[model samples]
Target: MKIGKSKNLRVGEWVVAIGSPFQLRFSVTSGIVSAKGRSIPNGSDSTYVPFIQTDVAINPGNSGGPLFNLEGEVIGINSQIYTRSGGYMGVSFAIPIDYAMDVADQLKENGYVARGWLGVSIQEVTSELAEALGMEVPKGALISQIIADSPAENSGLKEEDVILFFDGEEIFYSADLPLTVGAIRPDSKVNAMVLRDGLKKTITVTVGELPKDPALAFNETQQNFLGLVVEDQINDGRRLYIEGVMVTSIDPEGLAYESGIRRGDIVYSLGRAKISNVNEFKEILSSLDQEKSTTIGISRNGNKRILSLNLSK
Candidate 1:
């Protein structure tokens, strides 16, 4: 897969899709570059996977296929299709080769993607809400919730703060925050310009790793970290009754990566919690505030291991 430069995406230019559509191997579809930097939903998290919207007939088995330019250079990867009857609805989406390649590289290397942490929950601004807040409408993400102990919280970013610029990049919407933040290196300090109470202010923030589990009990809303979910697994007789918090997934660029924990890793204890499942471990983590760190003991692939993580407050 070729990683195209972000600047190379030309509008109205010819592009091709290479994939196995309808479970057919080696299928190729042709179309033009529809748009870039488009936003799509990813459950609770908003996916900034810029849609290479095309008229191509992308179907099943077409995933991972390349969308090539007229020059045969891969511009995007055919990924998903919007359909009501489980068929292409003429609005097929391809992951921009650049973005797809980036994600693939991160996933392959680190087990998950790493994003910058701004520590704020944002929503699209509305005229009524803007009027209520006494601001302009239809622009920028509204500060709906701010995570405590986050860079924004430490830097004085308050609720209703409208982020206008991150570093030097313009933040036209909330989705831009994750993209901008994710691009920053961990522990590096960056400036964020926000609109608060009609007054513009800049705050410096130290970037942190995106967490592997958003539902992690360490904090109610802290997901900017290395992704690795593990629990204690109890073994029984021939059935080998499995009970314990077992690692389901490990994100790339996380501390767990350095620790060599992979999928199916079973965690037994975190400082004597004796975790047997996700909920059991979650119960222990629930008591931990932002200032606490948890030392973990895990069993992976039948081997025992120990790791420590200072939970980000």
Candidate 2:
């Protein structure tokens, strides 16, 4: 069967789905492209896939079937449907063939799919945020936080910067930026135009291959002799966007925990020196005066405090 790209598909265009649902063999249904680039939380374990939404009758066995255009060329694969009674409710979704093909190509070549990744957390720019940032329009993605040691942190991207364009493509939405970046091959360098303090500037970032393990993607972590395993991430069981070295684990009888540091505590600074990323934090910690009392700043549950610890020489 011939295959076509879904990017050329338009909303309200006539489309067809061929599948077998509920023991019905070779069932066919028709629908229009209700929307594009829809994000839905599902069991697919895919957070970056922008599904093509439709009203086609997709259910049960229909999942792996083809969604074709009028020319009988497959544009997508029927994936899921929105329903309350465990039945079709007119809203269905499909994985865009173009994206599927890209993954397919990778799987065929490397036996594993590797997406382009930029280690940063982003949120959509709103009107109030735009006004606060002195932006003329509430478009583009606002960098909320950057992961330490990742491409974003190594590059010039900073917290609170508004990314307007990436690699010549305008980022109309935060979600758009992910899809745009994911489409690029890993290790590729791209120019990102950003607005910082009401000024526009371009930053070059080398895209990285998306890691299968979140721990690895973080580019953060080190097992220290202090009986503490630290990372460049902090999670309060809700979200991880803060900038600081974090204690992933620690020995209960270790000097760090005994010094009042706990797992999940964000190490903000040491010896009055502000910590930037994991590497710098490790460097500072290594060079600390042994057995001498040094002040360390930590934040837990939005509360900041200073603790004194002394390492034996």
Candidate 3:
């Protein structure tokens, strides 16, 4: 069977799906590609699969069916639907043939799938965040945190670095990074272009093997001060590393909570003192004057801003 390149797929282009929905064998449905590079959240994280979204009537039995282009070439595999009533609701997603073929080749060769890892927690670059980062346009994957003892850390990749390209290919979105990196073999060296502090720089990194178990729960330790419970953002064997202190919970009646401090906010700087970890955050709190307002720097959703709080009693 002839295969079509998903890279050539254009939005609004007509496509077809052949599947057995509700026991109806070999049912054919038609639709146009609605979107691309959509990131669907998976638990505390998200899958970077560049799904080809369509309005095709896909149902339970339609999964694993081939999606074809007008030329009768296979372009994708019908995988999921965005329905709320356990049936099709005008939205369906397909796995791009490009990615599916890569997985198939790996499974056929080694009987297992092995993906490359870059050891960085990334976020999308919004327009507001791009302006703050001195970027003319919002693009690329913004590095929010780097995993310790990983390829990113070893290659000197730091927080706030915007990964513009991987292996000479431009990263159109944050989700594109994982899709590109996963296709690479482990131990392979690749050059990445990143925007650091408003300047572009190239760094070479050796990709590592994706761990068999990648999900690690964050072990939060509570320390109450100013009505906020702060803890180190630690998730052993995972990529949930964040500098400064993470707010696990906030007491509604506490000063910090009343001052608009919310849970999940990472306090990077207290007043003028920069916080590098949980200990520093504690030390800064202990030495505070408690008689004046203080400003704290926080990185939330890739946008850095200051929050003022009346710490005085």
Candidate 4:
């Protein structure tokens, strides 16, 4: 059977899905492509798979089915469904057949699949973030943190640089970046266009193999202090009036970053003073002695850690 590429798929194109739903063998269903390059959050797996979204009836056991084009070619493989009721709810996703075949080939040849990586944590360019960054429009992925000694750092990809294009592919959202970078082979040179300080510049990088442990990119609100950017803990559509500030971004060379402070750390206190919000944190930071060592309390992955900032040194 001919394998088709998802990049060639057009929205609203008629397609057929073949699956065995609920013990029904070779069940057939029809639907139109709803979207392409859809990022369905499924932990880290979604970062690599640029899914094809459709309204096809994909139920339990429908996964691993072939999604065929009208021309009788397989374009994708049914992978998942988005449902709040534990069943198909009109939104189904498929892994592009071309991508699947590539992985299959790698597994057959090397016993494992290797993906290219640029170790930079990023966030979506929301309207507020755009204004803050002096961008005319909300687009592209904004670098929030650069993992130490990673390819991104080696390439001089600085924090706060907005990556508009990578390897000639435009990154409209943060999610688009992972899929684009992962497709390239390791040690391959790629040019990335970035917006920095209201200017656009291109930087060349040699892509590296994704580490055994992947670095994730995430986002939050604003409060710039102690060389750290933070926001209040939010839950269920509201800021949880908790005694902590969630770290979003930090200057790579700043004391906070060097002192074991990292993005996603929940700073609840400095020394003995409790931090209730961004404003309070700022106030506490203003009163700190730049020449004195200070201990800070933070929570990471549900574990509390006390990181010392030896500012005096």
Candidate 5:
């Protein structure tokens, strides 16, 4: 039996796991409740997901196996193990039945899981960022970029804005933002409180349907780091419009990547010069003589950021 999803799980439940350890087949292990709602890093990109902690003596090949209650009702799936000698260390972890069910459902329905999107890119507020910018303690998610015409952008979210709460939920860490916001239903208007320039501002945004495909938005290869493909920002009418080169895609290895520059960042100005279009962007790049690192200021998510990047000759 494969148990997925933790919504129905309870503490103090007896559970069993069956799998192979070190190629041992049909191994069985049992344990009582250890803990629940523990978080683990999802992948290399630094996202986190909550998991169930169990002491079921699990090991390799045990992953994806079911954890059963004494009643034989599956409660979790053995997923990971903590080991010092390439073997079970008596401590193992499982994806809760509910969470697993959610993952499986999403994968089956959408070909991928659609996480709730706040439509903003954020960074952990640092003390220097706090002091340099007069923040409280570097504990909130600072908006580094906001998607244009996105739910966040439409709701007036600005760059450099520090998010303190979402739907009355305190956002102390970056990881919490996604989980809390994703739990909210799409197409619902919700309140978000943020500290903009040290002042708290509340805005309401209707959560948009999250895209089923992650690659569609991230497919560009030469766009700026601020999340926009520009053409020009300088028509008498366009100056009011704020245009620039049409972004093609992000340079995956460019300075934009390390600086948290997303796929749609728009190039408005390099340093202080206004780049009207792609030709202007070329001019700016051509003007550079392979000297040292240059400070690039980009416009993203209705805000601006300065990044120092070393240019390769």
Candidate 6:
């Protein structure tokens, strides 16, 4: 069967799904491509699968069935559905034929898929975060953490770097990075464009092979004397471009809470020190003078503001 070019499929384009949903044989459904490059949350991290979303009626038995264009060319494979109930909810996802074919070829050759890996964790960029980072628009994946001894670390990809392009393809969302990186052959060098400190730069990286078990370990609580409870924004399971300490709770009568800092405030910078994570927040707080007023940069609900706190009072 001829395979359609999924890359050419655009939103609102007509498509068809042929499958055996709920044990019914040769069922056919028609729909339009609803969206692309969607990132869905998976456990602690998210999977960067550029799914072709459709209103196609795909159900439990429809997985692995071909999704075709009007020309009878296969464009995708019905893979998942978005539903609160155990039935179709007008939203279904298909693995793009390009990606699926790549995996199929690799598995047929080596009995397993060898996906290229870049050792980094990333999150999506929000409009508020873009302004805070001096970016004119919210695009690309924001590197939240770099794994030690990984290709990203070896290539000098640092935390807070916004990866704009990978191998000449623009990454419109954070999820696009993994989809692009995973399709490459391991040990191949590729060019990447990244925005660092509001400046655009290009770097080369030698992609590594995916580890059998890739896991990120984080702690539950941190100890700080600032009378505020903060967590690492990036690792807290929320996809956001701004990296800093997110205030989860505040002591009602404590210095921070009394200084107009409340729950849900993201502390981006304190005085002249930039805060990227909880550790950095604690470090900066350790050096602060208890008798002086301090200036803090915070983003509250997409609005940036400056807060001055008199710790001496």
Highest lDDT, which number?
4
Off by over 4 Å in 3: 44-48, 124-128, 168-175, 215-313
True lDDT of residue 155, candidate 3: 80
Task: Predict model 3's lDDT versus the native.
Answer: 0.76
What C-alpha lDDT values do all the predictions have?
0.63, 0.79, 0.76, 0.80, 0.63, 0.78
Candidate with maximal TM-score: 4
Expressed as tens digits, the lDDT of each residue in 1-313 for candidate 5 is: 5443465566666688877767888898898767665544322221324567777777778898888877677778788875547677777788767666776887888786665566776655656677877775766677777777877788788888888888876787654676566655567788889888678889887776555554433321123333233333223222344454423234334454555545335656665677766778877866765665666666554466676656542
- Rank by TM-score (best first): 4, 6, 2, 3, 1, 5
Query: If the candidates were sorted by their lDDT against the true structure, best first, what order would they fall in?
Result: 4, 2, 6, 3, 1, 5
Please report, as a residue range, the 10-residue window in candidate 3 with the lowest summed lDDT. Answer: 214-223
Those runs of model 6 whose alpha carbons end farther than 4 Å from true positions after fitting are: 44-48, 215-313
* Candidate 6 TM-score versus the reference: 0.65
TM-score to native of every candidate shown: 0.58, 0.64, 0.63, 0.68, 0.52, 0.65
Report the candidate with higher TM-score, 4 versus 5: 4
lDDT, candidate 4, 162-203, per-residue tens:
999999988887768878888777899999999999999999
lDDT of 3 at 291: 88
The candidate with the higher lDDT, 1 or 2, is 2
Please write out the lDDT profile of model 2 over residues 158-180, one tens digit for every residue. 99899999988788776577667
* Model 2 stretches astray by more than 4 angstroms: 167-170, 199-204, 216-313
lDDT, candidate 3, 135-237, per-residue tens: 9988898887677788788888898999999987688776578767776878889999999999999999898877765331111113345766555554334
- For residues 7-90, could you state the per-residue lDDT of candidate 6 as single tens digits? 888899999999898899999999999987664532212243668899998988999999999899999988988776768889
